[model samples]
Target: MTKRQKRMAAVLLLLAGLSVAAVLGFTAFSKNMMYFQTPSDIAGGKLPEGARIRLGGLVEKGSVQRGEGLVVNFSVADCDANLPVRYEGILPDLFREGQGVVAMGHMDGKTFVADEVLAKHDENYMPPELAEKLTTPDGKHSCAQFKSMGGST
Candidate 1:
């Protein structure tokens, strides 16, 4: 090939390689990304279909129920709705009712089948994602926000 043609071909090949790399990078990022949402958002059908998500909210009082073995069922509630969650493993030490939590998993029909559950580690600590969503108009975090909307403690 002529020198000019060879250089053109080389440029085209480089562009093609870059395009492939970009596509692969975007695919990997999207596959690994997990979105955070509240129970109200889930109720409104804001969940991504078949994608793993993090559900963040207050654990509803009187909702924790232990099933056979390590499986446990509970509800996560926001101001407008409550989402049922099922987890089949040992829970975090801080997991309990009336506390902020973030559960990572995918929706199985109407319930959130959590592969992992993370609870607030202290009285003053709430997950940043959950805190941001639940912040009061006065800029204060309030679990009472859920309680007033027919959620438990």
Candidate 2:
């Protein structure tokens, strides 16, 4: 082959290798991606069956129940819905009702089985995603509105 043909073949081979690498990278990224969802999204049946996700919301008041050992059950609530979560582990020191929380887990039938639970570290802090869902029109966190949306007082 001519020198020009050799160069063209080399370029094509390089392009093919880059394309394959790109595909593999994207595939791995998609597989490892964990999406964030709110209680409303889960209540609307937007969760894919058995897919791991981060559920962010406020822990509803009067919904915490302690079971044997470290098992605890509570409801995570948004402005319009609530999702029950069951977790079997020591909770964070800051975890409590009426606080923002993000639980990492998957659904078990109608309930969320959490593998990890993260509570907001401070009284004023809320996750950006959860804040967006719970913020009122006046740009304030509205506990009254949350209660009106089906959350417990």
Candidate 3:
């Protein structure tokens, strides 16, 4: 073949190999992608049953209940709605009522069967997921600014 024809063939082969590599990379990433949802989203029937997902929201006040076994029940809320969750394991030290948490598990009918529970790290800091919702465009918690200011009584 002519030199010009050989050069063109080599370029075409390289392009084809790059396209195949891109497709393979995308396929692998898509399979590993896990989405997080709020309690309201689950209540709205946006998620399918038996699908693995991360559910994040505030732990509902007065909803935590301890059973005889390791099983425990609690309700997670996103201000607009709440979801009941059941978990069988030791609770995290930071887990408590009225705090942000993310539970990873599958749905069993209306209840979320959590295999793992992540709680908020500190009282001053909000969970990353929940903080995003509470932050304004200027990157500040809207509610936190309104908190009482210290002054002489």
Candidate 4:
């Protein structure tokens, strides 16, 4: 091949390799990235369908339901708003209604299909995000208004 043709072919090959690398990099980043949001944020239509995200809130009272051996359905709420969540597989021992939880999953319309569930280690330990959201402006949890179901007060 002529010198010009050889140089042009080399440039095209480099561009093609760079494009492949970019596509692979983006795919890897998307697979690992996660965004956290409160139930209110999700209720306001701020959720995307494909990205894995965290929904942090209190498990709503009277919203836990068991359908099959390992399938459970519940709702996450931030006092003012609620988002339904569906999770399969064994749940944590600390999982229960009225406790703080953060679910990682994607939104399917109004429901969050969680692949993983995280609960507080004990009643004295609550997720910081949930604590901030559940407390009043005075820096205290309003016992009469928003008491912990079982999570830390």
Candidate 5:
């Protein structure tokens, strides 16, 4: 084969290898990409049943119920909609009623089968999955800040 032909062949082989690598990388990333949805979003039929997803909302007051075998049930709401979640594990220290939370799992009928749960520390804090929803319009803190005893605004 000519030198130019050999060079072209090498370039073609390199492109093919890169394409294969890209496909593999994309496949791996796609599996790890969990979609975030709120109760309202899911209620609107935007989510599919049994699909892996992240649900973010505030824990509803008086909706937490602890059961046997490390099972806990709670209701998550975004004011407009609410979803009941059943988690079978220890919860975070900050997990409480009326606090922001994000649960990762799949939907089973009307309830979310949570594999993991995260709770927001305070009004000024948000779970990593819900940070985008906490952005302010003026680029300031979207969450309510705690005031000092000295009457600082």
Candidate 6:
């Protein structure tokens, strides 16, 4: 082949290889990705069934229950809607009712089966993701509530 033709072939091969590498890299990274969502966002079936996601909201008052082993069940609410969560294993020290929290896991029917649970520490701390979702201008869960709790909006 002519030198110019050979060089063109090499360039095309390199571009193809790079494209494949990028696709594979993106696929691998996406497998570990977990999107954040609130109870209201998923209430209308906006979320894909059984997809991994970060469920964030306030722990509903009086919804906590301790079952066998390290299993604990509770509900997360954005004041307008609530998402039930079941978690197994030790919980964080700050976990409690009437508190903002984020759980990592997938949904099973109407319940979220969480493999990990995170609680906001300190009296003034709130997960930024959860805070943003709850900070609706006219919603019951407003930024004012965060301010009232001594948390920065």
The C-alpha lDDT values of all candidates are 0.75, 0.75, 0.73, 0.71, 0.73, 0.73
The residue-by-residue lDDT of candidate 1 on 1-153, one tens digit each, is: 999999999999999999999999977675234345677666766456778888878888788899999999998887667889999998888887777788999999988999998874435556799977865542124454432311211
Cα deviation in Å at residue 44, candidate 2? 2.0
Tens digit of per-residue lDDT, candidate 4, span 37-80: 66666665534466678877778778899988889999887666
Error of 3 at 5 (Å): 37
Query: Could you tell me which residue pairs clash in candidate 1?
Result: none
| TM-scores of all candidate predictions against the true structure | 0.58, 0.58, 0.58, 0.56, 0.58, 0.58
Which parts of model 2 have CA positions greater than 4 angstroms off?
1-35, 121-153
Model 1: residues >4 Å from true position, as ranges? 1-35, 121-141, 144-153
lDDT tens digits by residue: candidate 3, 1-153: 999999999999999999999999977674244345666566665556699988877777788999879999998776466789999998888897776777999999889999999884435665799966774442122223211111211
Model 5 lDDT per residue over 102-128, tens place:
899999999999999987555354578
TM-score of 2: 0.58
Worst lDDT run of 10 residues, candidate 6, spans 144-153
lDDT of 3: 0.73
Model 2, 1-153: lDDT tens digits are: 999999999999999999999999986675244345677666755556999888877788888999999999999887777899999998998798777788999999989999999874434666799977875443225332332212211
Cα-based RMSD of the predictions, in order?
A: 10.0, 9.5, 12.2, 12.2, 12.3, 10.4
| Candidate 6 ranges with C-alpha deviation above 4 Å | 1-35, 121-153
**Candidate 3 accuracy as TM-score:** 0.58
With a 3 Å backbone cut-off (N, CA, C), the pairs that clash in candidate 2 are none
Clashing pairs in 5: none
lDDT of residue 15 for candidate 5: 100
When 3 and 4 are scored with TM-score, the better candidate is 3
Which parts of model 4 have CA positions greater than 4 angstroms off? 1-35, 121-153
